[model samples]
Target: MINQNVTKRPVRIGLQLQPQHMDYATIRRVASKAEELGADILFNWDHFYPLYGEKDGLHFECWTMLAAWAESTSRVEIGALVTCNSYRNPELLADMARTVDHISDGRLILGIGSGWFERDYAEYGYEFGTAGGRLDDLATALPRIESRWGKLNPPPTRKIPVLIGGGGEKKTLRLVAKHADIWHSFADADVLEHKLGVLHGHCETVGRDPAEIEVSVEIGGSTDPKDGDRFRELGASLFTVGVGGPDPDLGPLREWLAWRDATNE
Candidate 1:
């Protein structure tokens, strides 16, 4: 369980506008609505094509869209749900994140993951290696990302928060313990409890304080304010709900916002 004293701060809400089959116009509108509704953060998935249904559906690049989102919204924080490591070089990715961080005036959260999806690798001309190999790549790239951030002509104006998303026990959680400001995972109450236990153990192994790492979960419609309260009890302070395209719905978002406000009050 999360240390209650450590998590006295109110829970935050994040919305992921999974860009699967939506056009640019719809994406813009949904982002605007999320900001208008007081979502703490707005996110887009990093994929070249739709991950579901028809694979070759409408899609857009992650960083480019994030740049646009930075310009479009004034108050909401924006970033990719998890930018694939294989899509760009580590230094370049760091630079891109710094640029967007400035564009949003310090509202960018850099969420990264070990590259997955065989289709993304094959279509984009990247080698699809074993899962362990990909995790190894991510491990190597993280420090380079930090190094390039320092070497950049203009360092990121704000300390961009690093969020690592994945639930692998051996490597992914270890990476989170080492480098992540926030760790996102998809699991139910029992599963989440187990993962948190493992993550705590990893933190101990690395000589890092577990409380320094924020825990997040990606939830669906079945999760609501009550469910969120239960998750909070379990140590999840950042709760994200995923909305898929085309014509994504914001009804649940509004409710979650209300829940956030109510809980915080």
Candidate 2:
């Protein structure tokens, strides 16, 4: 069980405006509305095609939209919900992140994960290697990304926070213990409890404090806001709610934001 005193970080709500099934104008509008509604972070996912709905629906790329978000939003932190590590060279991705960090005045979270979605690999001409191989590649890429951040001319505006998304008990949790500033997953309370215990073991093995990594839980569209209390008890401080668009609804997001405020108070 999580100790309340140990999980003292302020609760934060995030909005992931899935960049599919909608026009760019609609995304920008929703992003603005979410920030106005007080989302602590804004996220978009990285994929070549739609994850759901009409197969050929309108979609946008992740980093480019983030560059636009950097210029447009004044206060919200922006990033891919998790960029696929296999998509670009690690050093180049680091530079891109640093550039965006400066553009956003250091409000960028470098959320990333091992590549999945085989269609993305096949269509983009990247090798569709085994999951273990992909995770190994991600393991190799992270340090290069960190080293590149150090060597960049202006450097990152700050030590850009690394948010790693995955729950693979053996490898992913180990990597999170070694590197991640925030660890994200879509697990329910029971699953999260089990995973967090695994994560703590990894942290102990790595000689790191488990509490240093903030726990982030993804809030599903139909998930009840009260459920966040259970997550909080498991040490999740950041809750991200995802909405897809032709036109997305903001009402549930508003409810989460209110919960954040009340829970924090």
Candidate 3:
């Protein structure tokens, strides 16, 4: 588990450069622009195809783009919004993460979750198991992931923060308590508050400190700054604003970054 207290972290905004309906050139430009505008973390999603807009629209792979971002951008930490764990072997994922970490000079956050998209599973020939079974797979994978990180020839540049994304109380939150350095979830203020209570209870059972795990919210950049204030009061430190591709508008990202700076101050 991460040793730092959550209260010690300043509010930071993230931008998910969603890789759909656009060419790589456009996506690449947005990444650099987000950092220039002061986004603290930059993210992309792991999917074989588009999640929305169109079924067969333009899309790019997650980790490959991340590798490029590692080389291209200088300041913002880069990662997938949450990689599907079922896509690759846990050991291989650890290795890929390490390579990216070294490439980015240790600015990679391994945001991951159990497989979710049916299309990604069907198209990729992965078994779309029951939710319980998939959560179990993630449970089994986390230790192997950590162990593999330890045994790599050239270790991760840093501890390589694990950001687990999901809000399942029994399994996902338990996994987060046991494994994650950051927890990403989608919830309004009340739901988030309730989830944090559940997460803290899980931490207690596992002998982990609740504050060691950072809270992250998924949102659009245009979301209200008032809502952001509510989230901060609930202990959320990271906000990820998702922008879709094919001439994506970055206005919300700029607005949120200003909010981030103001909140941090």
Q: Please name the candidate that would achieve the greatest lDDT relative to the true structure.
A: 2
TM-score-based ranking: 2, 1, 3
- With a 3 Å backbone cut-off (N, CA, C), the pairs that clash in candidate 2 are none
Model 2, span 180-225: residue lDDT tens: 9999998889999999999999999999988889999998684568
For each candidate in the order shown, give its overall lDDT on alpha carbons: 0.89, 0.93, 0.90
Q: Could you estimate the TM-score for every candidate?
A: 0.97, 0.98, 0.97
Residue lDDT tens for model 1, 1-265: 6666436757889999998788889999999989988999999989888888787888888999999999999998898899999889999999999999999899999999997889988888999999999999999999999889989989998778999999999999999999999999888878888899999999999999888888888876544678877678777888888888888988888888888888888
Q: Model 2 Cα displacement at 60 (Å)?
A: 0.7
RMSD of 1: 1.1
lDDT string, candidate 3, 45-110, tens digits: 999899999999999999999999999999999999899999999999999999999999999999
Residue 44's lDDT in candidate 1? 92
lDDT (C-alpha) at residue 122 in model 2? 90
What value of lDDT does candidate 3 attain over all alpha carbons? 0.90
lDDT, residue 227, model 2: 86
| Distance from true location, Cα of 223 in model 1, Å | 5.7
The 10-residue segment with the lowest total lDDT in model 3: 1-10
